[model samples]
Target: MVHAFDFTAPDSYILNCSTLLTELPVLERAQAAKDAGFDQVEFWWPFDGNPTPTSAEVDEFITSLENAGVELKGLNFWAGNMAGGDRGMVSVIGAEDDFAANVAIVVEIGRRTGCRAFNALYGLRTEGQDPSGQDSTAAANLDLAARAVAEIDGTVLVEPVSGAEGYPLKRYADAAEVVAKVRSEGPANIAVLADFFHMSVNGDDVAAVIEVEAANFGHIQIADAEGRGAPGTGSLPLRDWIDRAYALGYTGQVALEYKQDRATAFDWLSHVTQTA
Candidate 1:
């Protein structure tokens, strides 16, 4: 309940620079958020193609946030070929080494920018690989990520990605189970990245999810169910759900992960940020 009133205001949450300013250059999106009146930002892995990016690239990425005068709030550990159809690789049969390689890099980024939550997307099912095998791989990789993130006083996030065919963790229980399994193996900082839009699309009672799983959520993201637009553009009672989440004991950054068409005018932010 630390940020309970934040449900009524914009400053309390971080803008998802990656998703918000997709039309802008990746390195320049942080500045875009800052220019748009946001003081904090989050992103998917900045490097889409390179998991083990060069140190120079890492420095530039960190510098982007620093230069933009925005605090880095959350980041995803690389999920493979996001544009080429891969949702993630941590749970894939032969991608363990690649996933492992990105752990330190992600942790190092977190250390540099003081970001504390790192999302680990569960990969899609293989054509012939057994379900159990993918599950096992996901658990092990999540455990590994938990250990690394814990070193920096960070949390490893498991998210339920929606509209993703064949991907695991499509439900709140699915992601929660992964977090529980990781915790059972003894890592305490592993938690779910509760994304209301995805949960809504998957036909869950999102408010009930907050009521039941609030304590286990490390972060939250929001977008309307209809067309995944800004809050008022669709039917979601966003303010109510946000308030519900705060009341239920979820104290974490609420990221704006909604999509935009060519024109990215975020007028809703001003309305939300206002106080009487």
Candidate 2:
């Protein structure tokens, strides 16, 4: 199998800016990455902070990409819909009127950028609800998500926040079940985003876990196990993921999405960038 290797970039993979679209202006950020020899990066909520940078901004962002020789890989949709939504992972189907209204804002962002991936939220659970009710409600919320993004032209990702309760998907299989069930319905737009740090926090078995959802797996976010910092900062057996990706015929972005406890995670990225 052919590995992505030099085929992928990581400069934009950082979540360094306190808020989306902040920090260096989009153009400057792209230029910096190009100067540093990176070909790929991502924008969190590119719509926030600034009035949607005009075509002028898109022009600049694109220009930076051309100059820096970088690719705008993907945009993670973080429109506050999931922020206070009970640690995330509910089905937005049952959200209060305000909740649905809130998510619409995120949907608008996806539409504007034509983003392919988005995180679905299901505000806090309904108090004093039963198991069957909860399951049905969750299912409804998943349906609502699929419907909301039906015209989004991209994929809507479902991620189970690490360290959360009941939704304990310490492994990919557990997570896959959630994805699979959601997709079992019509129009398979729902996919799973594997986050290594959270898996580590739950003491999950990555090898067996990832295989379960290998197919449904769309994007990946990883970092050292400690402090949610960049790789090389901790002792998480990360290479195993590379090995698994190759062996499983996986072809997706291994996004180095993590917090910048210091600068970016460019330390050992050179070798890995060429090999990615």
- The candidate scoring highest on TM-score is 1
Residue 157 miss distance in model 2 (angstroms)? 1.3
Model 1 lDDT at residue 247:
74
Off by over 4 Å in 2: 6-40, 43-86, 92-99, 102-108, 121-132, 165-170, 262-264, 271-276
Per-residue lDDT of model 2, residues 1-276, tens digit only: 745454224432433222222346655665555544555666654434332345555555456556765565555443333233343434323343433443465466556544456655333344566656665666656666667777776666665456446454445555567677777876587777777777777777766666765545777777678776666778887777755755676666666656662244465555333212
CA lDDT, candidate 2, residue 33: 51
Note the Cα lDDT for every prediction shown.
0.84, 0.56
Check candidate 1 and list the clashing pairs. Answer: none
- Report RMSD (Å) for each prediction in the order shown: 2.8, 5.6
lDDT of 1 by residue, 9-67 (tens): 55677888767888888899887777766788898888875789999989998898899
Alpha-carbon error at 6 in model 2, in Å?
4.5
- Residue-level error in angstroms, candidate 1, position 47: 0.9
